[model samples]
Target: MKKYSALLILGILFLILAACGSNDNSESSGGSGDSAPASNGNASSEKENQEEPAITNAIIRVAMKSEVDSLDPYQASATDTGIMMDNVFDGLFDTDENGELIPNLASDYQISEDNLTYTFTLIENATFHNGEDFTAEDVVYSYSRLAGLETGEPLSDKWAVVENVEATGDYEVKVTLKSVDSGFLARTIIAILPEGYEEQETHPIGAGPFKFVDYRPGQSLLLERNDDYYMEDKVPQAAEIEFVLMPDTQTAVLALQAGDIDIIPGVNAQQLMQLDDSVTTLSGPSNMPVIFGLNHAVEPLNDINVRKAINLAIDKDEIINTVMQGSATKIDSNFSPAMAFFYEDSVEGYYETDVEAAKELLAEAGYPDGFDLKMTVPSHATMYTDSAQIIADQLGKANINVTLDPVEWSTWLEQVYTDFNHESTIIGLTGKIDPYDVLIRFVDGYSRNFINYNNAEYNEMIEKAILETDDNERATHYKRAQEILAEDAASVFIMDPDSNTVMRDGVTGLKHYPIGKLNLEDLSITK
Candidate 1:
């Protein structure tokens, strides 16, 4: 798209050059009016016969649930922020239109005989947004910081296995892992930065298809095209992408109708029906599962019987058909079936709905009259609030008095997620390409395990799954880990709804990955 913008500017310059050359030719004719009259007549006739060229409008406006919590890739918490960063930063590896693993910064690589070390040959000629040459040292810095070498605490537990990282050559990076992982390729897509850039969290810079322009909290984020991107062929097609915060679905649908926005991602089926004929829709299964998360450390929920009763009371199939309009996949565990390679249907139909049985379980747990429960939910999207209402109604049927508490996204993030101060909450656990990334948040001792779930056997299974180098062996361990989560009734597992992407008349090119992320490079818009 940026290429087309450059070509259009050049075409206008060419027209100016032609007019100047005509004047020069006429001046060289020694003030003769003969050639001037003929030239003017031809120009007029040409203008009358030929139509003007149409300039393409290469810009797209997308909707965001809220402002990006952080600009730094390693520190970002909001899903929308991660999507924005994917366009502003280039990773060592990236996914294709079909969501397959492909090289981005690193051209190729080799693994050691014991499968503990990987040496990557970086691609030369790639430069950062600050005009610095990208080298292996930058990769080392990013990986080292990720593993708590720079900071006392690791930002995420997923990268805790990285034992060592060093620059073997200017463009060669070597990384040694504490354990063997067959799914480590997906982890290679982390954002790469300069060796010592300090303002990344405030004013970020990267060698991506897009560059950060401006951001305003609760309003919008603006990004401009990177014309000098390393891979010219893969430059973003859109000249600019503006993420407009649209916390309300109805308001966003109105914006799309008024031609103020070009796209609204993750729209439900009901929202799609409100649009007219001047729109296109792309639908596919999303890896994120809408879960009713229970606090295992809280009262009543700490008991296994009470947790099982809650799980048995809520009907997942009804939520899929009614709340999701039959557009979601019924999930029994944390792992989504969209990632078929590592997913197994081991716990399917395990908890059939029985309200009487749920009440009996409550009675067995010494809560015959049922206890009062407060469900904290984020009110950014009706997708969550609506489901919470239905689930709350379902729980009430089992004689469990429920109180609905809807809070803003930020408050929910701070209190319910970070503080873990609530009994239960409704949230979507976004998926990643790797299986471990999906389940790591629930594992014991994990910093992000806010659910407070602790099981020795489950932790041991996760350890075995990550260390096993063989694919089949790892699958066995992962499947058992998921089964353990189900047997313990860790949480009320919901459905993985289809990602419905709504675009205006001229917008196109939306890709679906195994992870929950959006890439704006392939999207194009026409005037």
Candidate 2:
């Protein structure tokens, strides 16, 4: 299905380009005075044709519950931001619908036998949205900036494995790794930017199927088709795409029903139940892990017993059924099932709802009457805050007082996520196709580890996993890392939220990648 969708879009784009070329040739030939002059009737017909609308093209309006914090690909961390950037930027590689990494900007790549070095040959004639020619120097600069080669804060911990990125030739680049990282190739999905990406704070330009046209924060982001896109075959079918910010899922569903919006990236189960036959729904397991993060820096939560007590108090099954509406799967570890080789299924069912045992554990941790804990959950979705409420009630039975503090998405990202100043938070850790991308967060001193979950054993295991070249050996290390988290009750494990997209019945070509991105390049509207 994925291949078919891509190929069909390619064929359509080829036809569009061919017709454009034909028009150019005709205009050049007909403008010569050597040719016979057109009659008045012919001139009038040409004016009428100029005034006609391009009915073959489309403009798709997608709705999202929250607005993006940043449009910069390197700084974006939320699902909505990722989706927006995915359209405006072209990465070195992109995963298929099944999460297998494939070449995108790079025509082909090679890995050394020892797995310490990787070489890539760039696609010739590729140009950024600003018409700047792309070359290996741009790739080197992007990677260097991401890896903090200049001695500043890195954009993401995902770049920690890179030793250095150097351009060997105008169209060739080589990346030397500090160690053998099996997941490094997949993690190269980070979008390649122009040589200098600093000035793109307000608007970003990249070699993508679409170009940034306009953006109004808290309102809508507009993108237009990039006629000069590197992969001409991947030129967006939609002449324009408008991502409108929705206040909530209810408003979005209403818009879908009223024909105000064409699609919603994530439609909850309740919202799905409310939609009529006019809406078409598509669903799959998401790579994101919705976790109840407990800040280990806090007083009582610092104790493993308290963390275990809190973990055992809540019933994951109830949360999965009642709160999630059976649209998710219960997970005991941080790893999701979407990560085929590394996920450990047997680790589940280790902790069941046992109020008495939880009480005993809390008492043992010097919290007999249950200490108060402040939990801040992002107000992005009702599911998150509702799950926090249910968890508060469950912990209350074990005499653990949890205060629910709901904040806006921006505030949550600033306070709980960036600053790491909160006692606890309920947020989803969006995963990438690579296992290392998700596992790197739990490493000591990781910027994204806002919960301050630090364990020497966990950090060591993750490091070992990164250096291991063999697939099975790396899996063993990853499994051990998960086992350590489970044993220590690192976080209140939640479920992998199901990705449910609700679109108009005639909407087609909206591909849902397992990593929770909506591939809108090929999206089209049909009556």
Candidate 3:
């Protein structure tokens, strides 16, 4: 293992992000370098053409990558599911156009001097979709259930450090953590439902800019504007928005060209090439790590030699150029370079394409002839399936027999992500405002530890990263964790796929978030 004797110390753990690779994460984060198009420059002209440029009741049809797996805010697992949850649920905190954490249900919040306690002043007029008033009790119910204080079955460690949650007043809630954690604000962005609201599986309710209308399996999810929303400034511009499931990128591109769909979010570079001048690309910042995951619980994968051999077997540069058409940022560590707070760039080019060396490593692991491995890919996301095919061929060169198992996104979520019933898979992990959310998934016993990786040194580093107050020291701990993941070959950390959204030339109000959500609150159509 190489030592990072000369570590680049980075401060400002705050993930105030805008475009994908910009120096600053401000409102104008997306610049010409990111290939992001200029803002709604013709917005004024379009307004003159219509009495209401931002139509109050206009419908903006969107493309969903897959069927929404679950309506429950807690069940948002994939990109499409997050998209659905973004509209139906409003959390205690929300993200701005540049991905900065902002007040949502909580109008204002104060952190204690020690940073262990958080006092929030809730929005008084906020109402749920079911016409229920949102209060501090609802916050207690939602967070307590997530922390396992209410259900007696802890779903996540989102509040693991939290010692208590109490409602001091009808509109005031205070959270006291055991220790200081600067990144605690990121966890507050998930949905805060009404107290004891449990019909989320069949029907969902929240206090976002939009209300649920209907959802048809394998078809679409419909949402209408929430007229009673407390935040009038951030109200939905369109009266209705429909998320139509379109798994195939080419088909979705065609639909967009035919004016059947208003927008296609997260389109790949190849799909961008297919669109003509009628539609423009809103290329924005992204911090997702598209990984070729290997379950450590599996037989051959449990062996570190086999894992390292698999890592050396494929060429990441080839995959990026062939499948992504150089539209992605090649990442060697689990973290993306866009998140400068913890991203370790020194590990880049650590593993070169060495097929013979990979074969030798396989022989060292007692597998003279590489064993067969099945890679489960979610078919809904074209990037995963397309990259899976290329990865299979690449691994085959080192005598590793590869088979592709493409499943629906929902099935992939349950089987691969939740059930831990897969050998290997290819998927993209979205980002958050804090590095904790990204690193926690790799913890051995974490709910999302589908990879089944376990390393004592790596685990200890992460534990220290969370507890460490000094930004330099905390980032150092995180850096070591990233180095360990690369050296240990935990997974084939690929690239941060550039976020590109396709929209008609005149359509505006498209903004890219660092967290990679296709927020539709500002979307509107203009002729």
Candidate 4:
């Protein structure tokens, strides 16, 4: 059966290639430039008219999988919500298209010689969506509110390194750190809330390109373009943006194909393959890692041999090929190829599928009969569930009994991190544009290390790497940490699939940013 499937896939690839050759005219539907129109006829003219519009009145309908948990920027965990909030709110610093840190709310920032303190000079003309002039006090207020002393949610662990955040002047905010942390700048990617946001959770205000208009819980979120935006000079072409929540991928894809939604930010691999050529597909490296997290503190997994066996049992290539439909690249390490540094080629991937070896290891660990295991997964995460199924099936081939318990994302997160048990589960780790961004959250034992898998040796090494100012030494320490993680089988690393976004051909100026963000500022639609 596998042989027949392989042959069918080869034949399909050949047919696709042959079709590509004959469809040259269809391939060149639009001009080859960032500003080029996706469709012909009056598109250029319509865009030109909107360029200097008598009234900037255009709506962009976007389909997303889930609604946001909280409007408070510091409290958001879902990427779907993060992307929306990120565009609607400005941070102290923002990453450009190339993933390089650039000034946003902060015009200029200076780090002290000791690197423990950073001072940011806020832009003078910036204002919140509510028309309040943005001041250094707003920055101080934003950070202080997330510090758990006020919000009591304990979401400010990312900024816990900062000892103090004070307004030195009308436009200058000074932040003092407990120690020199490498991820300080990237961590600033967290959206900054307007003053008194804790009291105004229902009506959050931000200094971003778009302002919050209305939000119907579990249905949709509406945002109107900020006409009086600080960066109005470089206005986002759309007049208003609507984020409509759809529960599943099939519905999201159907909405996009039916022209009900102009954009689907994150499209699943299977859905991307099924999309028509008329739809513009953007592919980029996702700064996320998919892994089967093991609870080493619990039984069965406490044995390193059992963990190693499970890692070797599942075939990552098969998962990427069958489950992901070749949309993903099999990954050996935690870092994505998008991250320029620390993605060492020498790091070997553990993708070898060997049922015999897995069984041998299980037997060596006194489980020759193959023990029963339960895997917890979120139904919303299609890819994670698919990967889990593949792993479960593969384990069954080795005489291992596996059961899948799928739950909602909220319940899954709560169980996986806080109330973790011996049950193995599949979850994805994202938000690692920089290596430090990953280390601070995963390895440093500070934030989101939800499984509570901590080692003093690992923590010491991570701390040393963060404090080390030398780039080379930091890289070395990070590499050591990654190697230790792989050797210890902390988690079964899976492939990092290519991130996908599907938009109609009529949509223009949709640029792919490296950090998995859709910059709709320059986007425009023309019939």
User: Which candidate tops lDDT?
Assistant: 3
Best by TM-score: 3
lDDT of 2 by residue, 1-527 (tens): 01122112222112111211000000000000000101121011111223333334788888866666777777765666777668888777776565555567887777787878888877887899888999999999999888887766566676766889999999989998877776677667778999976767788888888889888988999999898877767777788889898857788888888888987766667777787866666665655677899988888888999999998898988887886677676788887766666777778877888999999998888888988999987776777778889998988899878889988777887787778889988777765655677777778898878778889988988888778766677778888888888899998878776666667766665554556466777665564
Candidate 3 residue lDDT tens string, 1-527: 11111011112334434234311110001100111122232122222324446566778888766666678877556556776668878898766544566677877777676778888888899999999999999999888877777566666665667778999999999888888776676788888988987798778899998999988988999999998888887787788888887767678778888888987766666666777777756664467777899999998999888988988988888887877677678888788887775677789988888999999999999998889999987776656767789999999999999999988666777888888899998877776677777788788787788899889998898888887767778789888999999999998998776666777755667666666455677776665
Give all candidate RMSDs, comma-separated: 15.7, 12.9, 6.5, 11.1
User: What 10-residue stretch in candidate 4 is worst by lDDT?
Assistant: 23-32
State every prediction's TM-score relative to the real structure. 0.88, 0.88, 0.90, 0.86
Return the number of clashes found in candidate 1. Answer: 1
CA lDDT of each prediction against the hidden true structure? 0.72, 0.72, 0.74, 0.65
Clashes of each: 1, 0, 2, 0
Q: What is the overall TM-score of model 2 with all chains considered together? A: 0.88
lDDT of 1 by residue, 1-527 (tens): 01121112222112111211111000000000000011121121111212333223377888766667788888777666777677899888875433455778988777788878888888998998888999999999998988876675666777777888999999999898888865565678889988899898888898888998988888988998888898877677788889998877678789999999887766777777777767766555556766788889899899999999999999988887777777777887887676665776978777888999999999999999999999997777676778889998999999888899998777776787677789998777765666777777788877767678998988988888777766667778888988988899998888766666667765655554545456677665554
The lowest-lDDT stretch of 10 consecutive residues in candidate 3 is 24-33
Candidate 4's residue-wise lDDT over 166-195, tens digit each? 999999888888888866766676677777
Comparing 1 and 4 by lDDT, which wins? 1
